[model samples]
Target: MSFDLTKAETPKADDAETETAPEESAARRGGLVDFLSGPAGRNLGLVLALVLLIIVGILTGGERFASTDNALTILRLGSVIGVVSVGMTFVIAGEGIDLSVGAIVALCSVWATTIATQTMAADYHWSVMVFVALAVGAGCGLVNGVLIAYGRIAPFIATLAMLAAARGLAEIIAKRRTQIIRERGFVDFFGGSVAGVPVLVIMFAAVAAAGWVLLNRTTFGRRTLAIGGNPEAARLAGIRVQRHTMYLYILLGLACGIAAVMLMARTTTGTSTHGTLYELDAIAAVVIGGTLLSGGRATLVGTVLGVLIFTTLTNVFTLNNLDTSTQAVAKGAIIVAAVLLQQRVARTGST
Candidate 1:
């Protein structure tokens, strides 16, 4: 009974095994998580971009840039671009593009203005024209979807064709002239702000919130992501690839319509060339925000930040009296830089 060596040895062995088991398991788990998340880490670029923008804005505007008014201005500008990019994010994530967005926006603006000024004003139509304009956008998207999904056409070519067609339609209605509306209520609602905050900005937030919910929390979003990730894989998985692709275009069209309404409300006119080159801007915003151009993987918040980066740059240049051409050049350079940065991270893992 005095000091049994076997009992003492067994206790020591049990204690050693218990201590080592948890340490080894945690190490394995951490390694797996790190791999899944990737060494580059999502949104790292976005964070860096935001910091740099703030620094530049602070330097460029001096006290003005730091002011709340300046901040609101940045937000208002960013919001308009943000709304369009939000929809573009879905399309890009699904490996598609909408060249028709700019034209669609112009179309919506003219349509809404036509309704609000001509018939709705006299007949007391509470945004009936808005509904009609929305339907037009959805229809345009449906046509695009059919061609892309069913006809098996390339997305860029299909959307580029749609772009021309929609722009032509917008031209027909605008007649190459900007039609101004004298509706005070309409102008105030869109151009003016609620409690000093632009309605356009709020509208962007609403659209973004809806997009977030759709992409992150809904079944339609799941299908969109799956289709983007791999249409063939999605089909093999029993998901409706064709139908989803068609609907995704429709959704993008709907977003274009919404953007148009906001534009008309702000400007109180429908112009044929209102959204010239806006499709590129929207695409840039989506890409800068961290969405892979190849399809699949997107971040709603990243798109918002991307819009901010562009808008902030534009504002700084404008305040400094930079010409339009110069701003365009600068923006293009920035876009190239952002894309290159993303590509580097994508291929090399991390810096």
Candidate 2:
């Protein structure tokens, strides 16, 4: 009987360990998933996706797909939208949206190249035109911030109104015509490159660097995350949610100004039609970059990769003679897929 009891107890002990093993394995699996859905993981996934796309491009188009020229073209095309996407990242990170960004770009560009600003620049310095563009962008952002933060208007309505107003104003200023930039220095300086890298690319890199530092390294960035994650809790914790919200919009506006300058340099013209549907492109890049649409978390690296991915996809499509309509469809599908993935990740993390 004693021997039988010992054997039975030993079996029970072994069974307990076996039961615990599954629990341990499940915990490890959960941890792995959390890591994957985290910022670093998301960026890694985007990088892999980008590499896969590159491989597909190479397979489909041979050396032409991997050419240095094509690479530069992707960077160049991505730069303007990429810059705008940076600002959009801030807005979306704060649980907000700015539909007016593209319109703001067109407005800033038109304003900077207008006879008034251009004449002032020639009489003074070319930098004045740049200043005006940035100012107009900041000013527009300030308005959006005020309306949303103080006026208590909804972000969608506020920004949507701005989208129309800004575009309308641009048309009014330009008389529905394209304002060709006559400042050769402005064009040459911005369009030129340093060490064989386009200045536009440099500008994009610099902006992304600054954005990363601002969002990840500063008190302002911390507060932004707090507010987006939970505004009421953030307020109780001593954050100025309203003011911070306004500042977010202003940051976005400043980004649009930078984008406007880049667009003007590249195309040598500022038209009301410039930046049409740009908001969609910028938002897509941000969403595809892995930023949560519902707000709280922000990922600058993801945003950059998202920009490159979309830009590369567009380039590949063009090289293959695919239509713009096809590109649009692909983008829509991507947005839906990204949002779904985000929701799934959130659920898994919660469970």
Candidate 3:
């Protein structure tokens, strides 16, 4: 056993190195795969939420949930809300909020209603009406953008002021009364169904698809996420953060205006109190769908599922004779739960 100590130790050390090299390489590969395939593959909460929503829809609405007719109905109802949420999504993705969407929508619809409701015109040109309504909405958004971007105001405060002002303007325009209006025959097509499919549904699809591409595929989307993640870092990277923020707010305003057209068409009337509490619902949907309010990361499909879950729940509650107060309580509880889940996920991620 008294062999040459140096010669004996050299081979032993070499053997140990040979063994660890392969083992370490294998472990590294395995870790990478798991990271890519597990939680890193996609937003698990969002995917799970979609599955649960489909199950609930099937359970409550039965075949009606999966059926084309019911699916079409969901799209139709979800579209207008979805459109506003699209802009909301961008705003939230960029670490901001717009509280004035509902009021802006009410204003836009009432503006269009005045023109369409006129008896003497005898013809409500749908295209012209839509343009005017949307322009008004864009104008509101421009004001909001300037206030928040250049005026150096918090988004919540600026939009909240706009919310009160816009609602007041809407009420004044409607003479504080619900205005009943009839559009020309063809002008009503936006609210009408084609081949049993609602036009609003088609519009929603177009907008959502376009939005998805913008957020996922464009440089603008990447820059939005980057700024949300770290504005200072983004600014260092040569991105004009303020300009982008302004664009996003304006875009949100336009979306709200579009939503107004849908709502007005569906009801054919303008009311001062219309779209009340819709911002809450929209925010709830976005959050419940697993979109992070912290900004940078968002899920468009998840928002869709969130909207469906909320509306389905609302519809079911109504059908079951639930009181409005109870509904409010239920919605609030659900929102809290969703935020809690997101918080847990973040904690786990950090750990």
Candidate 4:
């Protein structure tokens, strides 16, 4: 038909290339959005926050803050709390709260350090103390789980009652005195390190790694997320919401027990005062780590970063000689800001 063969020969202006340019651009934008809205994105923000804190520490604390010793101190300070935060993460992810974590830590520490427990450790092995601490922690967690899961008690009330009861019990056991750890083996085991890292820090790392795997790579984690996201939906899907929920609390209890041991090692004493206000610290760390207070989502990495950030902040404040009142005020401000930012990010992602 004497068509424009010249035009056809000219490759039709390469419309495909031009068309794909827009598509490619759109794809790039989508990739960026996904990264920012996903765990990577959340962790990126935390990393940025930590970097900012580091910068602040440097500026305020000068060489003192920049020293290796200071850095180790920060990590050491964060280690115990970080372990507890990991457990707190699981509990929150399961759509539950644990106000008794601090009390449980106190109770575990006191119980493990009791005259009888210590006597057994002195007679046999320090593992006895470790076992008792873990048992106490698990027992407390079981009680909380039973009340919340089977007894149909509210998490807040149940844990609050535990808070009072546990703390009181610890006080009664310790008789308002600090119980010094006499088992040298227990202290050395948890207090020692591998390859220059503090044992406390190492334990924290191990727990965090295990927690990450548990939450992201296992069936149990999926079930926890399902329950937290929607208990009804998860149940409809055949997930055991009640039993799983109990497991979550018990998980937290074990964490508290570990934390108790760490604290006992660090301070060489177990007192009712041990873990005072720890619930607040652990909850704050978990929340700031990008875990949804209402459940459904959690980030163990973010929680670790949150713990570090707080530890660094405290270090910075201490280095700068800031008063506790000022530090408290600053913490409150950070918490408010983090929650606000989290809400904004959530909305942006949804849209």
Candidate 5:
């Protein structure tokens, strides 16, 4: 009887262990699910995609694609568009869009390189030209914000109008000619490198860092997310939806200004044609970076990676002698695929 009791108790202990094993497994599964649902989880896919593209480029293009010079070139080229993409991220996250960022860059660059600003640079400080570019960009963004937020106009139409207007203004200012940057210090410093890093690359890093802080660490960022997630709800929550919307546009405009400076420094010329089709590039990068197009989500790191991916792709294409038209086709396909993937993810998450 004693032996029988001990055997029965041993079976009970085994049963308890079996039950606890499932519980422990479920706990780990829950943790993994939570992680996959988080932002980092979302970005992981994009990072892997980027890594795959790099591998493909290396395999296809050989040493040229993997060279340090090409790598620097990709970064330098990507920085300008990357900055613009950062601004676009905010705009899209706030349930809004801007079709005029490229045009704004053109306008800002042209304005900064105008005779008046250049004359100021010659007489006073080269920094004055930098200020002018930022001012023009901020002003353009302010107009877009006011129209969308207060005027109750749609973002698409408002920014479309701005696209035409800003480009037109740039053309008029530059008289349909390229405005060469002749300010020696402006050319040397911005076009030069610091500790072997391109100034453009440095500027991109600074802007990305600042944007991450603004979108993650500040009240403004939270409000922006609230508004984008649900405007009516945000209004009920005591957030000034309209004003905040306007602020978002202004922030984007400021980014364009900074990008204008970078473009001017890199190319040494500002033209109405400078940022042509850049709007599409910025939008593509933002979307690919895992930022939801329906708003309420933003990822600066994702956008940076998106920029790098696009830039690297372009570099790979160029190295392989792919035509511009072919690149356009590929880019369009990517945009559609990304949108579809997002939809699928959203559906899965909802379930």
Candidate 6:
């Protein structure tokens, strides 16, 4: 009986170990899954890509590419586009596109830097120019939202029309000339910085941080994701898909306005050519940052990294004496690679 009891207890212990092993294994798997889906995991590839680019810069451009001044220059140049990219993130996340972002930037800048706006700024305050730029940006966004969300026009068609009209309007207003900003206060304030960082860079950081929070921690963001994932389903779920879509466009407009102000400060002039090809750049950055072009997923961190990558890439190319055509070719290749990688990731996730 004693020998039989010992054998029975051995079997029970073995069964217990078998049960615990699976639980432990499952716990480990769950943790891995969570980490991969989290922010750090989401951005790991971009981080590695950035690091590799930096290494290339160091190797090819040596000290010139590694200098702190050059680094700041990259950030400074990327800031305006980075801000615009933040807005583009929201729009694209909601399964909408705004091919008119560049045009809108040009229009806002021209409007804000016009002689009339300058005179008003001189009489009242520099804030006048800021307000005007914001108003114009929001207004254009409103029109786009209305056309797409309510009029039921496709995003591509609406934004394309806007791209043409806004650019034309900007050309008309500026008479195809650059409008110089005369508000010393405006320039000094926006161009100025705290603790040796450029104000433009600070603005970019602030906007990016805010965008991340808004997109991740708010009901509006949830609704945007829901709508992007499935518009009909989101509408059926009482998400007010149309209204939310309108708001997303308007949010993008506000970002364009902010970017306009930053651009004016950086260049001290507003021209119809302020954001040439910026829409393509923003779209590329957003796509490369891991946001789905088909919607339903987004990543602010990825977008920031994407912006830095392009900025750094340009800096590297410049330091190495590369030409614009070469840079364009490089960018095209990177975009293609990123899309392919994203597709593979999507397929793997689905499986």
Best by TM-score: 2
Worst 10-residue stretch by lDDT in candidate 4? 7-16
* Weakest lDDT window of 10 consecutive positions for candidate 6: 1-10
Q: lDDT by residue for model 6 over 1-351, one digit each (tens)?
A: 346776665667778899899999988876776666556776997899899999999999889888988889999999999999999999999999999999999999999998898999999999999999999999999999999999999999999999999999999999999888878999999999889899999999999999999999999889988999999999989999999999999999999999999999999999999888999889989988988888989999999999999999989999888999999999999999988877766665555
Residue 48 shift from truth in candidate 3, angstroms: 3.9
Off by over 4 Å in 6: 1-38
Residue 264 of candidate 6: its Cα lDDT? 93
Q: How high is the lDDT of residue 40 in model 2? A: 83
Candidate 5: clashing pairs of residues: none
In order, the Cα lDDT scores of the candidates are: 0.80, 0.93, 0.79, 0.93, 0.92, 0.93
Q: On TM-score, who's better, 2 or 4?
A: 2
Off by over 4 Å in 5: 1-34
lDDT of 4: 0.93
* Error of model 2, residue 322, in angstroms: 0.6
Q: What residue pairs are clashing in model 4?
A: none
**Residue pairs in candidate 2 whose N, alpha carbon or C atoms collide under 3 angstroms:** none
* Per-residue lDDT over 199-311 for candidate 2, one digit per residue giving the tens place of the 0 to 100 score: 99999999999999999999988998888889999999999999999999999999999999999999999999989999999999999999888789989999999999999
Going through the candidates in the order shown, the clash numbers are: 0, 0, 0, 0, 0, 0
Better of 2 and 5 by lDDT: 2
Per-residue lDDT tens digits for candidate 5, residues 250-293, read: 99999999999999999899889988899999999999888888
**Candidate 3, superposed: residue stretches over 4 Å from native:** 1-44, 50-71, 116-124
- TM-score for all models, in order of appearance: 0.85, 0.97, 0.84, 0.91, 0.91, 0.91
Question: After superposing candidate 1, which stretches have Cα over 4 Å from the reference?
Answer: 1-41, 115-117, 349-351
Candidate 3 has which clashing residue pairs, if any? Answer: none
Best by lDDT: 2
Runs off by more than 4 Å, candidate 2: 1-13
